[model samples]
Target: MKKNGEMAVRRPDDMHLHVRQGELMKVVVPQTAAVFKRAIIMPNILPPVTSAERLERYRERVVAAAGSASGFEPLMTFKIIPGLSPDVVQELKQAGALAGKLYPEGATTNSEDGVSDVQTIYPVLEEMQRNDIVLSIHGEDPDVFSLDREEAFLPTLRQFSRDFPDLRIVLEHLSSAAAVQAVAELPNVWGTITLHHLELTLDDLLGGELQPHYFCKPIVKRPSDRAAIQRAALSGSPKYFFGSDSAPHPVDRKHAPTARAGIFSAPVAYQGLLRFFGEHDALERIEGFTAVYGADFYGVPKNGDELVVRRQDWTAPDEVGGLVPYHAGEVFPYTVIPGWK
Candidate 1:
């Protein structure tokens, strides 16, 4: 509750997050674990977590990185590939996979192995549906123009909704007004609004000097799209929830001739969301967007602890884990108070 210049919110759960392996994971996991009680870890690293064995091992690494002090729970997921058997789906469920990520081949980073013909994985999808595992899609058609990719994928998403009537599908990182509206209209379908997508437009990426840091797959779209995302996030709709999609890349990779598509927002996700919601005069709804709704959608309980942010200004770090962070160097209206009881 807001009183005397402090707002206490339920400890959030980042429904979408990417903590890369080894050194990078060590550098970024704490930033998220410090604030979010739990996070759905993305399975798109090199030699992606495609099997139950890999998922278990990756989850261990994430847990080891997060440590016990913060009590961070890494909810694991498997990568969906062609010819994955129904037996493997059961194996993953037994291995603690909360979801499975579907990336259209050539769609994004390390996705060279992603599904080329989504229909080829129908058996796997049907198995996931039976096992009650959520399907998280990167909602873009590789054959379409960059701007039209997400909208172009709408038909496929609609098809999924029809085919797997009971399957819970999350249109990861919603990038357009049409996508946002589709998720709202479809039953058992929800959309994740990333920290970068909620505020960025194509202009932010290339309207003037090219800002490579804002470059991401399903690239941020028009201002109208941004407005629609903001409306969905602020509307306190359970169908739309927070998923930082906080993918991190080294500075050199981001600035390379072929820059990667990701924004390392885990470090500033909570602070940025607090400032955004406060500015919108919807501070009370922040809990649902950041913490409650996502957990409810996953059939998990809300975090019992509260994270208190004070009306104190703090500038975001210019670089986090050797990557430029979202809103780097910009001042935020609120900052998290360490060790909230």
Candidate 2:
């Protein structure tokens, strides 16, 4: 941080993000590349990216959408669905997938094809463990109550820690206190906490007349849970870092009779974080959470260049890509130097 209140830090990675296909991809992917040097692009598309071939095609679309944005790397991933051979795990690694996402069947949008039996994928997990690819788990059990979903998945994470002792795993967008403690105790496990989860609580979503933009899978838990996550994030623990999970759905789908589950924060995630961290006196911790830990966890080199964030006000647009972003219309107290995409 400079005397001018403009801080330059290494360009970061949105370790977990989703930019849906075709036109939507064109609209949103740039929002991420504009700020971060790299992003781990999620694979849960309409016909989810399940193979190296599909991943390659998706990468081309993402690259084209990114359009010569220098060094804006789209680190691709594959969805782990039923009947996917373990042999294909090696191919995914060779194809440059940083991780394989495990979404329990019926967990979230486009996850109907998610694996039902973790046992069925033991061979794949073993191969991933040997190959050193990270396993990104959705960390929810749909059969359980919404708020209890993440807690219920703790045992599964524990089992992975015990069985695949060498496999690196990331518990995505952890929303509960139990999850925070669970990840802390596990040696090979790391957690990615979203900007929305660190800021919003179940109260913000339902305490009033129901703010649909605050809704998301593994729905925001109690305030105590939010505090626990906040502690883990700002405490500067390398075990927990940022992954926006910046999912976007059209505005009609967001505020309809039944709203979709997601919070599109890519457009304002860094600015929002800048404000939140500054308010909490954790400004110095920002780069580590957003940039360093994730790349280190994935065995990639940290981004060399830097981005300057100044203490300037920039209000996010209410609508982006026909979608309502989380915290829509609110004024952020900080601004990225290069400005919004």
Candidate 3:
């Protein structure tokens, strides 16, 4: 993959990404489109994309924002709410939804309407299993302490694997070693590792200063957790793959008294990942981690085109599309060669 100071790999598919609705979406969608050929769009926007009509409309808006030339595919998902009709699952599949996101109530931003009890959505999960629709969960138990939430939710995850044995579940943005091991042990279950989680720790978020932007739901964990996640990603296991979780919030909202939980990583993700994989001597395996495994798991075709990165220094943008990006102002040794397919 690497030769003559350049690396080439399949254009990645971001398995988990959040491009919010309306004006904000317009600003961020293209950043992801630039580096990723497709992205699984999150559905937890205000009012949420719960119905078929809403999902179609949201997909349309995302496509429009991505524009005709980006060749970006927004793999849409619907929000999973309690009491959801099983019949509605068929409609969502017909509506082109590839998955359903389960956000525990009050777990993250705009998730106040999420499912509180895991069992309450069993009917919906049953339908999805029969229909082969993927179940993407936020994977945090809201009642627990911030650091313990992900660990606390493992029991529920285990129960789901036992109850709905055939369901394809994605435990999103894993932050701990325990979670990494749990996902590895479960069959038909996969985990998405965020760039922030791979590169950061609780220390990066709070051990220095109040880094509100680094603050995220299932907040980044200890150094050992980061190591475990890094090990998993580098281990070449098909069960773990890349998902930027590139959430963008307005500057004011991120800097406010109650700062939001997200990191706008789309702009920096690919380049940072190139450096990380290369430095770790795992450059050859990056293609599968970013572009192959997730698509294969979803039963989609891998991207035929390639994305190139040059061994060139570039500074990470301080602010992108009015939102702060991950590793802002840091100089990266590798940079994506823009507009080169």
Candidate 4:
């Protein structure tokens, strides 16, 4: 083992993450910044980031909130909805958007304003294709049962892939075997696997007493689903990489009546993931998954920066910014020494 069990790699990026807005963002952005060089900030805020101007404003808020955290950057994305103009899509690209995220109507948090029919946003998607903006997908059919939602939405991705052969589409936070296969086997398509989805299953949420924190949109699936995801993560597939999809919710909201659907994994994202990859003996691929591939897919330059991981074991902070983080109160085998500026 390296002295003090320390290893380093090109600094990674959280390809998909949610830092909410206002005060919550202040509380959570640093946790991610502590480990990642950049992250794709989800735009499903209260009103949602639909326009380039709004996206810029949100980016500014996020940049300021992150506050001189070394070289950390927040790559922004816009929420797609019906009737979005091609002109608006161009404006978003000009505003430095890495992609445009699609949330099916009523599918997840603040998605009531999302697309009811995928076709409704074809104009925007077409424009994105022409302009080279990646299309990030929330691959779940709201009408399907919670467990089956992600798989149910696969056909739509297939159709869209065929319809827009040149469009770059990323299936966000895949949660099922079917979804893993779709992204693994499909053409011109890619998928992001979340830490929670890869590690937790329905049983983790309901096996003993109700573990409310385990609940999330497209709720964790079967052990088979998790195993399949693990295979993909460890398979050394170039198409698959890291994206934490670390969505956070306030402790009150997470533990309350009807709870919310998200996991605040930012704080433990690095250490937890390092532990996971280590357990599988797939640690060699960590840098490619966390730092290289997503940047390659997004057409951005890989960060020249690097993150050093110490073999030291540490317990993750129980709460970050007043909200309970994923793996809260749990110990992990590794901790990041966060070197980049």
Best-matching candidate per lDDT: 3
What tens-digit string does per-residue lDDT give for candidate 3 at 173-258? 99999999999999978999999999998988999899998999889998999999999999999999999999989999999998
- Report the C-alpha lDDT of model 1 over 53-130, residue by residue, as the tens digit: 999999999999998899899999999977677789999999999999999999998888889887799999999999
Task: Score every model by TM-score.
Answer: 0.98, 0.97, 0.98, 0.97
Q: Residue-wise lDDT of candidate 2 within 6-75, one digit each (tens)?
A: 7788888899999998788898988888898889999999898888999999998998888784558899
List per-candidate RMSD values in Å. 1.0, 1.5, 1.0, 1.2
Name the 10 consecutive residues with the lowest summed lDDT in model 3: 1-10
Q: What clash count goes with each model?
A: 0, 0, 0, 2
How much lDDT does each candidate structure score? 0.91, 0.89, 0.91, 0.86
Let me know the TM-score candidate 3 reaches against the reference structure: 0.98
At residue 154, candidate 1 shows an lDDT of: 95
lDDT of 4 by residue, 202-301 (tens): 9899998988878888799899999998888888787888888888887888888789888888888878778989998878888888888899999889
Prediction 2 TM-score vs. true: 0.97
Model 2 is weakest, by summed lDDT over 10 consecutive residues, at 332-341
Of the pair 2 and 3, which is ahead by lDDT? 3
